[model samples]
Target: MTHGTSQSTSQSPAPTAPGAGAPSGRRPRRNKVPEVTLYFWIIKVLCTTVGETAADLLNEKAGLGLTGVSLLMSALLAVVLVVQFRTGAYRAGVYWTAVALISVVGTLISDNLTDNMGVPLETSTTVFAVVLAVVFTVWYRRERTLSIHHIDTTGREAFYWLAVLFTFALGTAAGDLVSERMDLGYWLSAVLFALAIAAVALAHRTLGLDAVGSFWIAYILTRPLGASIGDYLSQPTGDGGVGLGTVVTSALFLTVILGLVVYLAVTRKDVAPAQEAVRHAD
Candidate 1:
């Protein structure tokens, strides 16, 4: 979404104003993120799912302990981030690869906190939430806009990745907290988060919520929703999950992510246009 005053979606009409976060008619030097669209959301959720199961698969099936898996994935993430930054613009392959790796790394961070350090999931959730809030506050204060539409500057891109990393960690902690602590089972947790996302969509579409606010809230919410889904499919039924196993679940989602990435790369359908000056309500 653009960084500007919002127009209302409810009722007849509301006075609309342009967002200053992204200057109108001023093209970004290099668009580092995809346009916010259905494709973006779909791939984001899939990446979250992979974040959960792939972490499990690597830690367990791949015979890498938590520390080993964490280190390995983190190194890979660093390498990809370097490549992503070097390319300069948003290449679908580079961008999505970084996202997928970051997802894994995010999951590992939460796991390290909760499992290795004996921190409670609830505590971790609260901690990550606070950390994410601080990051956003600082980012917005510095940039004057938290909108992803114009992530062209190095500082903005840096803030963007930092925020994304926190979101994944926060999502993992919260999802596990709800499913394990609250005894809500992975399936029920997925449904709950899904409904919450739907509510956010409705609020934005019909209740005149700000476009940027709605987008970020939904983006944060989807992480837990997708993680719950991944856990439900991969965990054992005896443990309140469907028992597809981590290997299978990871493979399935990875395949879908790969296909979608290829489609976006070949078609460039999700690329941000040079003139993305306005963001409208659905």
Candidate 2:
């Protein structure tokens, strides 16, 4: 039930206000998500896969429909997010639960476009990619950086969540387009995404891609990887899946996530400092 490693102790140097001299030797603000470790990525992909199966379970198997499922999950996501934002620091349970809910909600958004409205997966993918790009552009322009290592303020948290939402939506669209339209089966698609994430990691380790870029690239890829795994597990065997069913798959992953969250909460493993300095120093 280990969620991830505890918060990092390395402090970032403080930045100065526009046109002002920088602060001297102040600590950098800690990021929201834990440091990009093997454990972090493992749980992220798990939550996303669960998100896909969970959404399908409620919408199709459970007869909630797209709109009904979206509404219910969105309401629950909002409640969890409220609790997450209100807390003074990170609690793994509240944070990861919100993430899982948003994952489902994001999948439903793309599903609504394709299933309910007949929009093509390619079109949805393009639209979401553009939206995500725009969000990153704006966030970078205003904040002057996009590093996950410094997310102490409420505004940064908002931006982080928004970007995450788009990642899930984009991943769902791209994955479906590849699997259904492009005729790449779930297993191959998952392999492709896993490779892409591996490439990002290699780039970070060998080519010195900034930590922020590496993190986001891997984060975006995890969604599709998770969705493919979810489909492979939950869909019927006739359709090439193991036929475990969405209910079982979702419940299993949720239990694992909950166990990890509870352990982290008790240990305070994911908690970071309340007010640290900015780290965009040269």
Candidate 3:
């Protein structure tokens, strides 16, 4: 499951290059995001899986159809984002909570487009891809970098989360389109995306792909990979799933996410070096 070392920049933007200290007087800011670690990717994929299954659980069992479930998750996501923004540094609990909520909201967004509004997955996928590109274009234009390491400022943090949201939405649409069009079952779809992620890693290692580029590409691919896994576990067997049901799948993944977040909080192993610099500086 592990790919590279703790210092692998291929997983994320290279953390503040060695000894690149802050200027004369101003205090250094801690990055809002965690350092890319084995734990980071593990928890990220789990969160995406929970996002898919939990949304379905709510839609089917909570008596809240697509629209109702969408509104409920969206409101909760807004509240979590507010709390996340107000925090001074990367709080593992709050940060991961916000991510998990945003994942559900992203799934809902894509589901609403496809199931409620009768939009085609093809159209939604293309639209979300374009929107994500625009977000990145504006984010880079304004901040001069798309690297997560510099997400210490409110503006950069905003851009980061916005991009994350679109990635999940895009992944959902793209995953569904591919699975249906290619007649691939949930398991096969997961494998396909997993292979794509592997290729991206290979490109980064051998072909000299940019760190940020490789990270974001893998990040987007994880969404669909996780979603396909979620579907495979939760859907009925006749529907090409194991029939474990969404409740079981969501609970399983959420429990794993909670445990991993707690571990990261306690160990602080995933804290970015830049954030550590800020801490030591303070």
Candidate 4:
């Protein structure tokens, strides 16, 4: 079964609003993220895992302290986001690059709290949860809707990225708290997160959970699931990992993400033009 946003059954071309474009009569705006396909989920999980492993590699092996690593990654994220924002339409390479960078930066935010400031994971988790709620509340207050399918305006896009950043940070803290405090180990923690995501999907399918709610729930769960997988692959065997080493794991995932992003950029397979049209019609 597919996860994240449920697929739209309607196959008709999306509607377009009058005067929705520049005086040149261009088409209306569209969603930035890929369509909710198996490929989308695969790449999302891969990017999250890369974020975890890459952060660990930089902080530990590259001799960058948490603060240093965070600053560097944050800078990179900013640059990528600028490129993403400047593009007139969805470009997979620019979009996914921003996502991968944000993933690493998000993990670093939590690491700074727990490792550098000695804040408890519980506290970080709570703070991030509150922050995420505030973002959503404010976003909905201004935008009138929280549907990812309607992500066309600059305001909506801003809120969407902010919410995404908080989800990563919250997921990092929650996942770490569960794994370390409960001693569930990386593999088991991954299994638990996967199971939880599955339950969310079941609720969406069987219990009539709203599409936005189900999407956000799954999006949040992906962080921990990705982090757990990263830890399981990168840590030493004695520590319950496969001993792949952080460098290798990070490299492998990054390479795959890059390849996929390139393919999507060329093919435009994930562009959500149909959804954008539907929103305009509404």
lDDT tens readout by residue for model 4, 116-215: 9999998999999999999999886665566666565666678889999999999999999898888999999999999998899899888977667788
The top-ranked prediction according to TM-score is 3
Selected candidate, larger TM-score, 1 vs 3: 3
lDDT of 3 by residue, 1-282 (tens): 133333243444423443443211222367788888888899999999998999989998989889998999999999999998888889999999999998999999999999989999999999999999999998876666787766776777888999999999998899889988998899999999999999988887788777677888899999999999999999999999999999999999999999999999998998966577768788
The candidates, ranked best first by lDDT, are 3, 4, 1, 2
Stretches off by above 4 angstroms in model 3 are 1-28
**Model 1 lDDT, residue 36, Cα:** 69
Q: Please write out the lDDT profile of model 1 over residues 1-282, one tens digit for every residue.
A: 222222212211211244544332323356678876678889999999999899988988668789999999999999988787666567888999999999999999999998899999889999999999999998877666677765666777888899999989998888888777678878888899999988887887778787777777887888889898998899999987889999899999989999999998888777644423322110
Better of 1 and 4 by lDDT: 4
List where candidate 4 sits over 4 angstroms from the true fold: 1-28, 273-282
Global lDDT scores for all candidate models? 0.80, 0.76, 0.85, 0.81
lDDT of 2 by residue, 53-172 (tens): 988888876677789889999999999888876765555677788889999999999999999999998899999999999999977765656666555556767788899999999989
Q: How many backbone overlaps does candidate 1 show? A: 2
Which ranges in model 1 have alpha carbons more than 4 Å from their true place?
1-28, 275-282
User: Against the hidden true structure, what lDDT does model 3 obtain?
Assistant: 0.85
Sort by TM-score, top down from the best: 3, 4, 1, 2
TM-score of each: 0.86, 0.85, 0.90, 0.88
> For residue 125, what is the lDDT in candidate 4?
100
